[model samples]
Target: MPAMTVNDAPVMFDMDPETPLLWALRDAANLTGTKYGCGVGDCGACMVLIDGEALRSCLVTIAEAEGRTITTIEGLSRDRSHPVQQALVAEQAIQCGFCTPGIVMAAASLLRRNPDPSEADIREAIPNLCRCGVYPRLIAAVQRAGRVTRRRETISAAPAPGIDPADAARAVPAMGPASGGEADGGTTEPED
Candidate 1:
């Protein structure tokens, strides 16, 4: 069994030591945010923060992760409030969303090390591939996130999670008797 602290929780994997951390997370731990792109590590889709460093979970085995701290996208923020996630949404840098998780993890790791990362630094640090070709916006988004992290700016583009029931009802039009619609068990249309 390999013991590791994941998302600030101590976890032990009851599987083969040689199993890749990606499988351990997705299959055993049910952390599916870490994706599986290129299993050989060329793709950054399996990226995760291992001890505050962006590492490919597919390339790192459970044995290598022993006693290490791991951070997945889910651990980054429960409400998508992380600067990286917010900036990504604000800049609309995500498409298809298959690669977004890995990109978020990579960007989060980069920002942690360099809160004021330059475009070049972001490029160098985040090798995650976005087939959506959001590279240009991604760079800008990272810069925006850096500013937010450094407290130089703020963004309210990312929606807050867990909407209140009342607010949700207000946003959505009433579909029942409240909207003047009949709530009776009888059919609305005339009988044939």
Candidate 2:
């Protein structure tokens, strides 16, 4: 059995040591946020934050992760208020949703290291591919997240009247079945 901390929670796995962390997280731990793109780790779709650094889970085995901390997209925040998450949401940086989690995680890790990274720096940091071709928006979101993070760090009490309270509040909606599409991406029709 391998012992590790995931999303600040302790866990032990009874699977083989060679099992990829992605499989361990999804199958054993029931954390589906860490996606599986290319099993060979060529794609960044399986990215996760290991000790505050972005890493491809598919290439990392359970035994290799022993005694280390892993953070999937789910663990980023209970209400999804992490600045990166908020910025992604604000910028509507998701489409198809297949690659969003990994991109978000990569951006998060970059922000953790460089809070005020340059545009070029963000471009270099987030090498994750999005089939949706939303890189421009993704960059904008990263910039927005940086601003939001800085505001939080510097602001003391109340934001100026001109500031959008929503940005400052970083409000997250309650988790449940939203009125859009089904869990399987099936379209939902409005009730008559």
lDDT of 1 by residue, 1-192 (tens): 999999999999999999999999999999999999889998899999999999999999999999999999989898898999999999999899999999999999899889998889999998988888999999999999999999999989577765777776666545224432355554455337
Task: State the lDDT at 28 in candidate 1.
Answer: 99
Off by over 4 Å in 2: 152-192
What's the TM-score of each model vs. the native?
0.83, 0.78
Please report the candidate that would top TM-score against the real structure: 1
Q: Residue 153 in candidate 2 has what lDDT?
A: 38
Residue pairs in clash, model 1: none
| Lowest lDDT block of 10, candidate 2 | 154-163
Model 1 regions more than 4 Å off: 161-192
Error of model 2, residue 29, in angstroms: 0.5
lDDT of each: 0.90, 0.84
Candidate 2 per-residue C-alpha lDDT over 46-138 given as tens digits, one digit per residue, 9 for 90 to 100: 999988889999999999999999999989875667888778777878788899889989999998888888999998889888999889899
